[model samples]
Target: MTAYEYKVVPAPAKGERARGIKGTEARFSHSLERVMNDMAADGWEYQRAETLPSDERSGLASTVTVWRNVLVFRRGKAGDVAAYQPRKLDAPKPYVLTTPLAEAVHDQQTATGTSDPDQPLAHPMNTLVALPVASTAPPETPRLGETPEVARTARVAATDNGVEETQDLHQMSSILRDRAARLIAAEQPGRS
Candidate 1:
């Protein structure tokens, strides 16, 4: 499990006032661009912002309702071994051909004066089907002094039953790259 530290601050105003009106605070969305830029410098990420309702009794028969925005910021706690600990990924076992066709092919190849045991058999009725065998080696680990960008690109796309997937930050590159290419092409001179 991952742990996080949270900070709650008053949401910035989109209108006239800066800190919002006291007591009867109006509903306004905070400018997250500024907050995110500032927080990103300090290694904090903006998770989400929430607006809560605060009700106060103005009189015996009247209740005043006020909505205030609460900006939430979170950062992963540092030095948490569990968060950074590498998950064990067991490699897939290689599959050996155990079908009757395979055995027959082997026998036929032997009878035909073929000495190579690894040679593929070509039969009319019993066409030998070769299934791809997965490697039995363990998953590759990041070497010392390796950058995060390199490590991210080297991870295999598949996962096993008992292992959990690591957090990936570079999955959107393909989509973003296509969009960027289209944008660049559109800006080029003289395209009617």
Candidate 2:
């Protein structure tokens, strides 16, 4: 049997309770819970869980935040590994809204270098853009730029320099033919 190790953070306290507002706090808690449930549903068993303390500044705040971690494990036969794949959950779509105040603030900041130093640093918003989704089906053909013939030729050429020299001669002939074709095309343009 093949052993597979996985980690997951189970749903936090917020998800267990019916919270009126689905704010950032609720989302964070829900994310943790979803990860745990998803892993458990995939045959993974909980191995461990721990709470990570917040930094000194944050720890002293009125509402302290701590990281909740969970680890899970699973085992399967080598042949069964491929068939045990689970479907991935769809990512939440982004909603766009215009903010006149935000736009004005941004414009002012651009005009004057002076801005709120206490505010969080501006990050590249596009960094969070979702990557092109991939299909679950296995690829039908080898990936692009991967040629078995070229690979074999390269291997043979490396081991046998004499074969490489012969291959170079054939390549030279092809190059010469290409150059001749270009020259003929250039000359025929004048006739046209």
Candidate 3:
């Protein structure tokens, strides 16, 4: 196992806002850089800055939050430099689940001769063939004073050639909506 140590420092003070001498402000602000370099030379690496807030009572029945910026640095545990070296970890094992309903479905498919014993069942609505069906019936002439763009066309079949299967687009969309809801629910953290 690896361990780390942290250091917290108050945010660097800014140079004087009033103009006086050229580069004086930059020179004054460089104090923070000097301190950081000095820490780095001692094996500390700069991490990040954070703003901490605390509520303080200002007057009776009122409270104010005071925010303070802090700079953070971290380093490995003392005398344990080897713990920081990168090492490979074994891959996680795959999860296997068995359910009664799944077995029932497999048995029913085998009994009905609808699926091969070695092959998995295929869902009919999972794959849809979308083809533009040419209209053989005579097209209806547009009514008087009606623009051609306003004329509605027949719906094309969403199936393979010469197949009489009908798939409900609304049902497919609802299934997708339900799956998305399940995924969103799984992503939320549980309360303690």
What local lDDT score does residue 170 receive in model 3, on the 0 to 100 scale? 50
Q: After superposition, how far is residue 39 of candidate 2 from its true place, in Å?
A: 2.3
Candidate 1 residue-wise lDDT, 15-130, digit = tens: 33356443323423234456667787997778788999999889798999989887788888986668877889999899776776567667777777675866655554654555
lDDT (tens digit, per residue) of candidate 3 on 1-192? 668999988876664333453476675566567768878999889999899997999988999999988889999889787886788899999864356545655666766677675665565343233445899864576667766555443223322366576676655577788998888888887821
Q: Rank candidates, lDDT, best first.
A: 1, 3, 2
Q: Per-model C-alpha lDDT, please?
A: 0.70, 0.59, 0.70
Give TM per candidate.
0.39, 0.22, 0.35
Q: How close is candidate 2 to the true structure, as a TM-score?
A: 0.22
Clashing pairs in 2: 11-33
Lowest-lDDT window of 10 residues in candidate 2?
Answer: 121-130
**Order by TM-score, highest first:** 1, 3, 2
Deviation (Å) of 181 in candidate 2? 99
The whole-model C-alpha lDDT of candidate 1 against the native structure comes to 0.70
Which of candidates 1 and 2 is the stronger one according to TM-score? 1
Question: Pairs clashing in candidate 1?
Answer: none
The global Cα lDDT (0 to 1) of model 3 is 0.70
